[model samples]
Target: MSEQNQDKHQQRQQKVKQKVDERIAAAQKEQGIFQVITGNGKGKSTSGFGTVARAVGHGMKAAVCQFIKGTWECGERNLLEKAGVEFVIMNTGFTWETQNKESDTVAAQVTWQEAKRMLKDESINLVMLDEITYMITYGYIDLDDVLEAVSSRPAMQSVIITGRGAHRKLTDLADTVSEVRNVKHAFDAGIKAQKGFDY
Candidate 1:
């Protein structure tokens, strides 16, 4: 074949393969169930909140159980609440910020109990467990319990678990996993977190 004809043949082959892959992926998307967003970088909870907005936009019920860093005002929470999203704030903030392990543990337990309820509720189409990895890392909640709750959730229900240091077991069980890596952050340059951006 001539050079131009060969090139055209390869391009046509690539297009066919791309279409096949797209169809395969669509076929595999049986029912959205579990997702894990984790990393040292920011935006985990932000991504989860985005999913909450999407779910609520589609007229689906959604809930958020904030496991840590709940003392500060969250713009997403305000907007989501107004949109009819249920929220359960642990209200203990970060462990380092609180400087009390017992208090953090107590708050995590309370939040975990509520999370369990939400996970089991078939009425809720989307559930966001914001900053839950910290509770798992600190042993504030049982890993097995979390695994079981996620496993038993309704097949059509979607869950977003977000935080840093997500457990390997959780990632293994997630239908989709995304880790946001920090390349450059303004906080590294001594810029304090700005409202509506960080908080």
Candidate 2:
């Protein structure tokens, strides 16, 4: 490249670096962040689990409350359980499949009790509520209870909520919200949910 072009490139990069430095310097607070991963696409729970794994990798205490799950084995749970991450499963599977609102409500409430305990426990560094939005949607769990527990959680405890069509209140309270759009999915093409990949 010509010296003039190279000089211009250097100047542009220098300005970019300055902006980045300023932004970095401006962010000085250290506190746990609430993250919401929701949308019509897959991978919401996967993303939440990934964050739990990241916390475990850093030797942080983490707990996961899996709503609307059955007895099926989870790959992430298998690994994280061994890593000392506490797990509370609703064990009700899909609400449509269960077709028993009374029993499902009971199960949801029981699982939510465990989640509330984890949220109040200051020792736990992170809590992942997997597919919890469905419970709220079905009225199986109280939305106010969830909001209160999360909002009152330990200041250093981070929470991750993942599901489709998350409540507006949750999105508003979250520090980071990510929406996964469904452009295409293998299930629509008659592809079965593979073990490790889907679970």
What lDDT does each candidate get? 0.91, 0.93
Model 1, residue pairs in steric clash = none
Instruction: Quote each prediction's TM-score.
Output: 0.89, 0.95
Residue pairs in collision within model 2: none
Candidate 2 per-residue lDDT over residues 1-199, each given as its tens digit? 9999999999999999999999999999888899999999989989998999999999999999999765778999999999999999988788888899999999999998999999999999999999999999989888888899999999989999999989999999999999999999999999999999999
Which candidate should be chosen as best, given lDDT against the real structure? 2
Off by over 4 Å in 2: none
- Candidate 1: give its CA RMSD in angstroms: 3.1
Model 1 — which ten-residue stretch has the worst lDDT? 24-33
